[model samples]
Target: MKPVDEYFINQKEPYQSIMLYVRGLILNTLPEAEEKFSYKIPFYNCHNKPMVYLNILKGKDYVDVCFVQGILLEKKFPILRNDNKRKQVRSIQLKNLEDLDHENFIALLHEASHVLSHSKKAWFI
Candidate 1:
């Protein structure tokens, strides 16, 4: 199995389901996104640039869907949180699939892609 698949399969209940659901939302929204395992987690790349990543931080109860240039996207998406004090990376934490705002999350994904397409500098660097 692909490492990305294994990463999802290895996760425990609730978290595993949450990650899978978020993963589907991401792929369905950005069909061109490339899914790869990086930093031991699932990372999505768009237009050949890192766009987002998913992970369940140690001791954290929720799955983190982190946008690479979230700082810029935050102007439009106040839902994105920087609770960890990350400068550019902002994320939404999902404890259950019910917590996901489908329309808003998909819109955020599209916005993040837009931000990536307009910027020339690599955001992930």
Candidate 2:
């Protein structure tokens, strides 16, 4: 695939809204996260690797926000959905602004931030 700038950069309307929504939430949570343009997508990298990635593939109807380490969250928070489609990583779908889960959504972002903070502070084993 070409660089994200060549692919997603051309998306218009709804696709941009959904992708931006997730992107805004991620930036709001980790204000200092470094943005990465890799694998034809936008990845939020912290502590050197990605914490989450937002990809808007060509022709796809919805943009995807992928938690790079979502498997751990699935194990820690059993209440987190464990649908068959979420076998590897986890994601919250947003059709519009209304699809935002607010409270739990913020919590997930915090959890990702916490994981990165700990990994950097020697708090991780």
Candidate 3:
């Protein structure tokens, strides 16, 4: 299996389920995304730009679905976290299935992909 595949397959119960679901949501929304392992986590690049990434947080309680150009989409969705000292990445933390907001998640994914594809700046860098 690919390293990224192994990463997800090795996760425990609810974390596994959450990661799988988020993976589906992202791929379904952006079919062109290329999935790979970067920083030992699952990273997706869509339209030749950094798109999204998924991973289980260190404590093992949640999975973080991170958007590369999160700062642009933050105002649109309140669920996105901008806590990191770096301002470029934003993410949604999922602790359980209940935390999955399908509508908002899909919308955010689409917007993130759009920004990655259209933005002239090197947002990924």
- CA shift at 34, candidate 3, in angstroms? 1.3
TM-score against truth, every candidate = 0.96, 0.72, 0.90
Q: lDDT per residue, candidate 3, 1-125, as tens digits?
A: 78988998898889889888888877888888888888989998888777788867665467888888887888988798975565688888888989888998888888787877788753744
User: Which ten contiguous residues of candidate 3 have the minimum total lDDT?
Assistant: 116-125
Task: List runs of model 2 lying over 4 Å from the truth.
Answer: 1-9, 57-60, 75-88, 119-125
Best by TM-score: 1
User: What is residue 25's positional error in candidate 1, in angstroms?
Assistant: 0.9
- Please, what are the lDDT tens digits per residue for candidate 1 over residues 8-108? 99999999999999899889889999999999999999988889999889989999999999999897999899989997999999999888889999999
Better of 1 and 2 by TM-score: 1
lDDT of 2 by residue, 1-125 (tens): 54644545576768777776677777788787877887667888777767878765455555566776676676664434434365555655555667677777778878876776666431222
C-alpha lDDT of all candidate models, in order: 0.91, 0.66, 0.82
In order of TM-score, best first, we have 1, 3, 2
Off by over 4 Å in 3: 121-125
Worst 10 residues of 1 by lDDT: 116-125
